[model samples]
Target chain A: MASVETTRSGGDTGLPDLVLRGMTLGYLGWMVVLPIIALGFQSLVAGPQAFLDAVLDPQAVHALKLTVVTALVMVVINVVMGTATAWVLVRYEFPGKKVMNALIDLPFAVPTVVTGLMLVLLYGPSSVLGTILGTYGFSVIYSQPGIVLALLFVSYPFVIRSVQPVLLELDRAEEEAAATMGASGWLTFWRVTLPTLAPAIFTGAALSFGRALGEFGSVILVAGNQPMKTKTTPLYVFGEIESGNKQGAMAVSLVLLALSLGVLISLNLYQRRWSLEDGK
Target chain B: MKTRVQGLAFFFLALGVGLVAGCGGSSGPDASGDVIKLGAYSVVREAFHDALIPAFQEHWKQKTGRVVRFEESYNASGAQARAIASGFDADVAILSHTGDMNQLVEAKRVSPDWAKNPTGGIVTHSVVVIGHREGNPKAIADWSDLAKPGVGVLYPDPKTSGGARWNINAIYGSAYLASKAAGGGTPDLAAVADLLKRVQANVVNMDASGRQSMSSFSERGIGDAVVTYENEILLRKREGKPIEYVVPEATLLIESPAAVVDSSVEKHKNREVATEFLAFLTSVEGQKILASYGFRPVDQTSPLLPEFPKPAKLFTMADLGGWDEVQTAVYGPKGLWTSIFSDQGK
Candidate 1:
């Protein structure tokens, strides 16, 4: 309580400080808290039995399972591939390296629906690769694989963007020292570089997974939107709304909101702990 | 600390007030209440936007001394209906199916006697027709041909799309009629369910709308044939796209309904203008405009365009016990369509 009083009084606080604090709180309340509160009340409006029925519906359960499984898979793929991409961009010099680095953010720039369309065009049944795979009864688009592919495209830049700056700021002296001690490239990367990169990689992977959990546009376009098959939670919520089931839609939406909020809180806590460790 | 908490509470209270103000305060009458909002389904979007609206404006201007301005929003029928029912403030709603209008009627957003008008609550009509690649390579002439091996069928999902529900009912109803004609007995639900199952097996993907499914067939080359609205096929043909379409014998007639949303019109106090707009939609001149855009006019006696081909056997929603019974029987829990695709059906 003393520290809080000192923070308010000890600084060169002015009207701008008060005004800015008010503005920030106003924006946060109006945009974030209000909508979430509205959704919360709407979900509970139908009472406990209806809420349970919506959450435990067979299609809802299957969609939740699919959403989680696909997001987890996306986290793993992005952590590895995105880290590799960042490492290559930072370390290697190639003819088109600059273009490739810029191209890494294209997924973020292009619309999700366009990404889904491109994936379906390239790997759907119309393509040569798709045809060969279809012969073996392995389909890409309109299946679980397509959902993962779309998630990978959208979440591609997360880990790369997170790890790139860390890699750039990292001192390479330790890796050079390890090299002089006769450590192999893989050994140096494993024992030295990866340890330092772990925190950024995990943070970015968590963010990517959180994003995948709420993905709807690209997943709906490519995953065929088959209930209890490739339908994700967001798509299920959409279906519920379109079918005039507002209670069911609100319930599923609250589920997604809770999951994303959990991710955000955990990430915030992780960052706070790391900052405390760095301060000490 | 207590002051800060009070500030936070005041902020939230202000936010709640702002939300209510933002939503509720916009719909009051301006200087003059000559503006009417029209919410419609996507299949009729181009027609309403391009052909019908301009003509209606001209007609209204000629009929009345003052000009009427319209604000329109279009999407899936069910989506539009939900928006209107949940307070989107649409004065008149032109939807793709009776199911959506029925939902609004049930919600009291629309008047119960909306159908007591001239055209029986429907304004536009079409049949579930098939669109195929140029030259008709699959030789698909009827619904049963889609069930043949190696034929990939494309249609939207019934769960989200009103048009898709009509398409599915067309398939089921056509099969039931065929079976009944052969035996002179009532439709066997088992046989009808089996036919639907066979067609479901060839489904490449159930897109969200008839327009989307048509694009997946025509542009993406995903499926061999698409079940879509007859007007969509005619519109594409008019566009000189290298596509051919056939209306199957014994197909379900798609009856799209229009209504003056009672609550919205009453709120806006534009009930007279909204009613006029709806009546104009089913008028002879309006029917002609709809025909130009490939929609079969709701007035059966109205002259159809020369380019529009009539289906040999057209069945109404009544043939299959209307949308409620059909939705329950085919798309409901333990519904045959759901069971045919997955084990999730009760």
Candidate 2:
């Protein structure tokens, strides 16, 4: 609390402190706030009715719905798989464990477009696996599943990274006490470990969901980009802008920007509350 | 501690100033020589970069006894037109269709009467054709064949690609002609919509640009046929890629136009060179190079004209009541083509 207060006030309202604070805030405002304000102004320039029309346009609505649904699907799978990955990394020792941990962050480093291309190479209609899946009538590429798959790849590291540190730092004494009290291993994990990991899992899920919402490069290649079908919101915005419908593009972009901002703001609030509880 | 904070602040301020300066510091045309910026659609990238620009530089140098460097940019036709209209500052603009050119005119970047030239501002000619695998296993002879069940098709999304609009227009136009013939001079809009819907249903993927669609067809092997320009398939063949294509019996004539962007040329003081470059593209020598690159020459009298076969029932934008009418009738909200997706729910 003392450290927090000192950092908040910067110990003194001296010239260097004011200069540092002003510069940081100015940089953020210039780089981030300005563009968001510009987008909002452009979309609202024609009035709220136009903005509503653009957002509610059947094609636009369909794109927004598709983006949200695919992201949600990705989040559900990521929560399960990512939690399992973190669990194994922390609770077990194995060969190549270090290499596996390093490789988990590779998805974040690789370009999203390359991620899209890699996925297409593996699951496109002509690939051996894709052809095999096609015979079963469960096509992957150029469909909703492909969209979710690309989202999963791009957001793969989010949940795992968030949960790993929490898992490592977790106090094992409570689980041991539960086991010594006759609780089964699964029961101990559910009653003791999961509650501690829930916040980290939620943070990871929220972060990945926000990331997936704006995933353009990877999803655009796999999604067939059929309007009212595979086209996502970012693709719709690009199409509108390229086709000289700037108003429509701006309106849809504003919607996405607002959605991502809402997610990040709520995550911040949740983390702040959780940290306060932890401090107690 | 205070000095460290001050140093960090100075560092950030300098970084900000440097970023701003870097973005604004692009050099203008050099005074010792002339330069012309050419903004064109993506399909013409190979032709312009490899053949036309070098040929034009030689022609300009021989005529004026001065070096004329060219700056080139190629994008989807509509995107290219939007770029030029929004201050991209290209002295010359070559696009896939008049509708895109008209966008520049409306923006006052080009003269309203820019098409008043020997070639009506059109520098190249092509036709909407179907590109299939070698030997054409599916036998996609016409637009109707593309609508058949189990026949996978590929075309770019028209909203982003001007070439895709032409491909879709060809299908719609052919269907319109058939409906007109059956209705004894009255075209059936419903029939055109039905055919477009069916073909759209079979489309395996719709990439953002025509080049991407061609790649999806040739490299990915995702579709049985690709609705694209004849010149695209010819260019692939020139590269020794085994590709087969068909010129549909009734197809829309693809007229690609080039015009000097008045605002850009005026700003760069490059009007003279830019004007001459457009003139050269229609000249017999220029036409010859374009023809070699698979573009149909605009000048019908050029010897290369015979190499391009005429379609049985060739039609123009005017035949479909011009670009403005077609834009509204096909692409506008509630237009036939636009509504097809909504009604079919695909």
The best candidate by DockQ is 2
Give the Cα lDDT of each candidate.
Answer: 0.86, 0.91
Report the lDDT tens digits of candidate 1 across residue range A41-101.
Answer: 9899889999998898788888999999999988988999989999999988899998998
Best by lDDT: 2
Error of model 2, residue A161, in angstroms = 0.8
Query: Under CAPRI classification, how is model 1 graded?
Result: acceptable
Docking class of 2: medium
What is the clash count for each candidate, in the order shown? 0, 0
Pairs that collide in candidate 1 are none
The pairs that clash in candidate 2 are none
